[model samples]
Target: MTLYRQLIIFTVVLFLLLFTGTWYAKLANTRTFLTDQLESHVQDTATSLALSVSPHVAQKDLTTVEGMINALFDRGYYQRITYTDPRGEVLIDRTLPVKVEDVPQWFVKLVPLKTPEAEADVMAGWNQGGTILVKSHPGYAYETLWNEVISMTVWFAGCAVFMLAAVGIGLKLLLKPLAAVERQADALGRGEYELQDPLPRTREFKSVAEAMNRMTVKVKEMFGEQAARAEGLQERAYHDPLTGIGNRRYFETQVGADLGEGQGRGLLILARVHALEALNTERGLQAGDELLKRVALLLQEAVSGYGDAVLSRLTGGDFGIFLPHHSSAEAEIVATEIASELGRLARERLSLSDNIANLGVAAYEGSVTLSRLLSEADLALSAAQSKGANGWELRAVSGESALPMGQQQWKESLVKALEERRVTLDAQAVIANTKERGVRQLELFARIAQEDGTALDAALFLPIAERLKLVSAIDRMVIEEALRFDFRSIGVERIAVNISPTSLEDEAFRGWLHGYLKGLPAGAPHINFEFSEFAAVQHLEMIREFAAAVRACGHGIGLDHYGRSFSKLGYLKSLRPEYVKIDRAYTGELLSGENDSGFYVASLCSVAHSIDIAVVAEGVESEEQAAVLKELNLDAMQGYFFGRPRPLSSFTAA
Candidate 1:
């Protein structure tokens, strides 16, 4: 029960006990007093009658005594009157039958009043003779007891009502402080850490209130300190402090997260100012920085919309944006607007002799990772820069007539590469450092050999393949070829295959992969599919579905270039991949003077380990970097210093 109800019940019970005891005591005392009064009246009447009838007895006047008895009855002071002779025989008796309506028979029987009888000895001139007996009636005594009980009941009921009202009011006043404490607790639950108001004068309540207020203040201070620290870290990680726009790191992180969620079609616009180095040389650093800031502002204003869009300064004169759910047409519109805004802002603010800004727009249909997007946008921006001042261009579609001949030729070559399965798998050996045991795991890399016997590096052809929407088909072909290679004969337990973001976006690719892997020979537990952090994050839902399908077929998922994003780490818990490869940018600088890189790498390792995610250090070229990574409890290492990329047949021969 609630406290209020319990208190009221307790008070009522206490009152009833006291009231019942008081009533019982008063009733007993009243009964005793009435009995004494009746006894006294009986004695006095009997003595007086005996004295008055002594002369009559001596004169032999029985009639006079009988007449006196009748007179007493006429007085109506009793229900019964009797006079007895000295010989123990009744001389006169007067008794009336009980009336039905006078009093209840049960009540009369329960509270029977015993009126005492008194006797007086009558003597004639000093001679002892017969006794004169007189008895008092019980009805008069019962009447007196009933009147006393009625008065006591009235007093008790009045006191009980007053006590109940007083107790109820007092309890409410006493619990008011507790109610305030409850309200404060509720507010705290809602993340409001304000202290409760002052409580009442009750000592217990005052102490409790003070303690609660102190706790609230301490918790608020702690959270404030944490928030401040988080904000400081965010500023260092995400913002270009000088320009007040997002930094390159922040831009990369945001794009990675957007791609991971597959929230919108990936569209990135990279804007760069041509001749920035020359401009700085000619106009000085101050003017150049000011111009860059103006450009950033212009870019920010251009992409402003209800949906998610971010503009960030990636470098000195380069700015980047990731627009959500934007189509190719929408991207072109935004690019035009940005180009116009940049021109206007330059003319208004820079006081430039000529317009110096160039904008490059690139839109991806499905999942596109930050690295791929950056490379494509950069390529487009370079094209614009080469064309001279104020010239802006959207990245050329592979088959579009606008593409240069070289790009068009490259697109045809990539298509030919796919049809002929000219793509060859190159394996880089990732060897664990040990004197007694040297086991190598191959990291699968793709190389495209043309029909003319000219091999193309992924650095050149992969971006073109992605631009032409041919990456997924190329990635699928690579996986199929890797599975065909007998890695067991090469003394390798596992091989890693790189999967592009576009590959994950292809729903049919996952089904084909599942069907192919299901036919793999039993006990072949060595094939692992690797995805870059940017690519994996771009198509997280698809990646998850693909990962599940792969694992079902005895393969596992590994995240490459991990920690390249600034999004929530919660997805890592859900993905729960076999391993996370630390980004090369971080691992490559492990031996350098940059302590923050090591710390960041270590923090990622810690977080991943907490969720049972094994950490691998990518680009660990030096023994020193490898040692440091090992000290951080990294699970694996890969770099050119350990092994270089070679053809699959060469790997098998080794």
Candidate 2:
């Protein structure tokens, strides 16, 4: 029971006990007072009557005495009246039965009123002639006693009601602080530190509330420190401090994990400044550093429009760019744009050669290893340098099954695919680390079929779709297919689908998705929309609004490729995703005997777990990596080790 209710019950019991004691005392006093009054009346009446009838008794006038007694008896105030001779013989006798009216029989029985009898002598010239006896009736006394009892009960009942109302409200107000403390504790358990404001007036409650507020502040500080540590480790390990982009190590690891698994199809561009050593010797290292920073800024701005672009500083005066799901046609546009931007920089007279830089672009279809792809890009760079200053060259795949198509052709293909509903979903199981090898959820990937009976992964086509502004249409089709899918056939109750952050910017798509989620049946699988960490941070507020809306309909959101971007970890608190899937680059480093990755993963887990968020590792290709991740307290894991992506129809009903 709640403390409020317990206090209320105790108050009522106390009132009842008090009322009972007071009620009995009042009843006893009233009964005694009525009995005394009855006795005094009987005695007075008998004495007065005997005095009046003494003359008659002494004169031997029995008729007068009897007449006088009858007159008094007729008044009905006396229960019995009698006149006796000196020899103890009764001369006259009168009696009436007692009857009470206008009072309850139970009251009368509960409180029996006593009748009083009195006797007096009849004197005749100083001689006792006869005795007169009178008895009082208890009907009037019983009626008076009953009325007092009724009045006292009503008075006590009225006071009880008034007191109960006042006490109930008072207790609620006084204990309100305790309720606030309880809520604060609950939020704290979920890694949210909330303080109780406007402390209670009660001394003990105020103290307790103050303590809770202090504790919350301490917890917030602890989590902030922990997040800062993780972000610092991430910076030292994967980021280029001078340019705020990825370091060469980060680029190699990320590219290998993303592209080496036969799942990545994209273009890689390498840009090298013509004479950084000469510029440094002539204008000092500071000027050369400033020029590099400017070049890095230019590249970042050029590729900002591509959602999946990756830029990194490979070495001194050498830069690399990776645009997944892009074709050689798109690569030419990007390379020309870069050369044009660098030309403008050269004309600025920052002690640079007129050539500025040369660019080499290599487009791959995921059939080549990372080393071979880099070698091809290096050869392309050499060719561009030989061509002339500010020249660029594109080295695309040679006679591949999936040829690189132009922008217009790619757009036409994607539009027709969506129109014909040729999109297929490939699901991979994300399993939880438990005794049962529990399946957490099936993450769905979208693939568009081609005329050659070959299906292209979304990574191969989504960039073009985004460029063509057909992303919203494609996402809508994917959501429709997933919702209509019979997930229960495989006994899975939850599924996660990747959603484009760009789709959230489209107001119509957002409204339609909200409505569709709300209208889903009760038995429908709970949906978790996922967004890449980089894109999610770019459009934080839009994603936050969409998440809130969907969550109201029993849906949630998650972050994919977590820790890939350098955005602050604090956003995790603001977004509060159901889970974060760590980027596969970090997972691949498990067997490399690198202490930084382990510490970074541990800190990330601590920060996320503190806020009650689940952590999942992606790209778990080996049992060794899974063993290392399980030690880091990862809630779940995904990759080829668990299961490869397969058609949804491949699973049989349990």
Candidate 3:
């Protein structure tokens, strides 16, 4: 339970106990006072009546005595009234009907009310004639006591409610500072070394806050000092100090890790500035260093979109990058981007020297080591130098292959593809097994069709589009097509469309998407937006904003290709995505012999299930794979064995 609730309950309970005891005491005192008042009132009434009736008693006038007694009875002051002569003989009597025996006789006897009896001597002319007597009614006294008890109870109940409310509010305020302290301590443990705002002026809280603030300041100062030292050492260990890019050691470490794990399939690019020593000798060392820095900056900016792609200055004038998880087309796009940026920088530096930067790129796949990747890239670089300066060559693993067009050619093709509306949609089905038959879901895929009506595979052209910085245009086209598609006719319960991370970063693109989605037909509830786990993790804040925008339009968000990178499961709980498509690699190995893929998949399913996220297995190619996934209780499955990628026109409504 929260501290606020616990504190409030404790305060209210304690107050109730104290209030109850006090209320009981007040009730007892009121009852006693009422009883005493009744006793005194009866005694006085009897004495006054006895004196008044004495003359009649001495005259032996029964009628006068009876009249006086009847007057007292008519007043209704007593439950029972009795009058007896001096000889103790009954003369007049009045009593109420008995109903179910009033308070138990034993209980009444234990704490009996003392009914005071009054006596007077009847006389004629101040002489005694006969004795008149009166006794108080116990029932009347009991009734008065009961009335007082009811009044006391009502007052106590009202006071208890008021006191409990007041105590609850006060306790909550008193514990507010303690709650703040706990939150601050939690933040500190999570490595957020900053103190929260100042606490209230409670003495104990103030002291603790001051101490925490001091400790945070000290820790931050120490970290800053240590970071400075580490930066200096890193410069010597892994960076080219003049160029501000990684040195040879950094290159080896990165390439080694990528090739060692076979983590992602991609190309490596190596480039060298020719005649650096000659330039330094003829001009000056300062000019040469400036040239290297310019080249390093150009390379860095070119591959900025490829998250985790590493660039380093291997040695004098040479730079390299391991493009993990990128295809041959992606590598070519990176090479062109770098080459263009370098060309611009070279032109600006031409006023100082007549040197032009040259570039080289290579693409490889299928279990390559670091040495082989580097060697291939270097071979391509050497080939580019041999052909001519200010040019680049792209080598493939099969042999050295040359790029036919320049950056302008690639850029024009991407622009034309968007303008011509050549993008087409492909979809894969997600099936859910229910008691009666099953449910079919579709995932949207983007394909580029050429002018000749031949559909170009996404694998061939997406890299080029991205390299030309036209991914946002392609993404927008995909969204437009998805919105326009009639999925209801095809019986697709849900249509998931992939949104690029690059497009999400563009505020203009986000605005355009929101406006477009707002105008979509009201009956279309099947459209769902998706973003890759790798992209979402890299630009978390941007993706989150996009997801919120999508959800506002009455659609849901999904994570595609989840588990591409190691991510905290906590994000799943916070983002609360509707579904996640497990990465194909994990699914492919799930049924491999002598492997524990079943356990791994089951664990992932369990975690996702815990947060109410539906998990779908991707790239399931066999019945065995599907059975294993079903055994794990996977929510859905998609692969070639079940159904190959096809156009939306291929399927009909069920």
Error of 2 at 313 (Å): 1.5
Which run of 10 residues does model 2 get worst, by summed lDDT? 397-406
lDDT of 1 by residue, 1-654 (tens): 868889999999999999999888888787788888888988887788778778887787889977876887677555566666666787777876534244556766767677687878776668654676667777766766777777889999999899999998999888888878888877665446667664568888999999989988876675455444434554676679868878886676556645643323546888777667777888899888888877777776776542256678888877788775455666668877776676666566473545667777777654456677778877888787766656666763322112223467877888987888898877787666444326546788888897767566564567567768898898888887887777777677888888776766777876787777888787564677887776666678878887887887777889887765445555775576888888775675567576666667767776676556778777767778777877787777877667767788776446
Model 2 clashing residue pairs (backbone): none
> Who wins the TM-score comparison?
2
Q: Write the per-residue lDDT of candidate 3 for residues 1-654, one digit (tens) a residue.
A: 987788777766876787678766775675577667777787777778777887787788878888987788666655556667656676777664422144555545544565555655556556655555555556655555556555767877788788768876777688777777777766554434667576679888788888887877775565454434434444555567787777676567556644543323567888887678877887788878877887888787887777656678888888887776566766667777776776676667632443365666767645666777778877888787766546778876632222233456756766887889988888888877333325557887888876667675554466567666788889899878876767777656578887667777678888898898888787774567887776767777777777777788887888876654444544664566788887665676665562444555666666666546789888777888887778788898888767878886666766
lDDT of 2 by residue, 66-151 (tens): 98889888977778898888899986878888788899888778788788999999988788898999999788788788888889
- lDDT against the true structure, per candidate, is 0.71, 0.87, 0.69
Cand. 2 TM to true fold: 0.87
Candidate scoring better on TM-score of 2 and 3: 2
Candidate 1 vs candidate 3, TM-score winner: 3
Question: What's each prediction's TM-score?
Answer: 0.56, 0.87, 0.58
Q: Which candidate's lDDT is highest?
A: 2
Candidate 1, residue 508: lDDT: 86
Mark the regions of model 3 whose C-alpha exceeds 4 Å error after superposition.
1-7, 79-87, 96-116, 119-131, 138-176, 182-196, 211-242, 248-269, 275-291, 301-310, 321-358, 361-380, 383-461, 464-499, 503-541, 547-654
lDDT of 3: 0.69
CA lDDT, candidate 1, residue 385: 72
- Which 10-residue window in model 1 sums to the lowest lDDT? 396-405
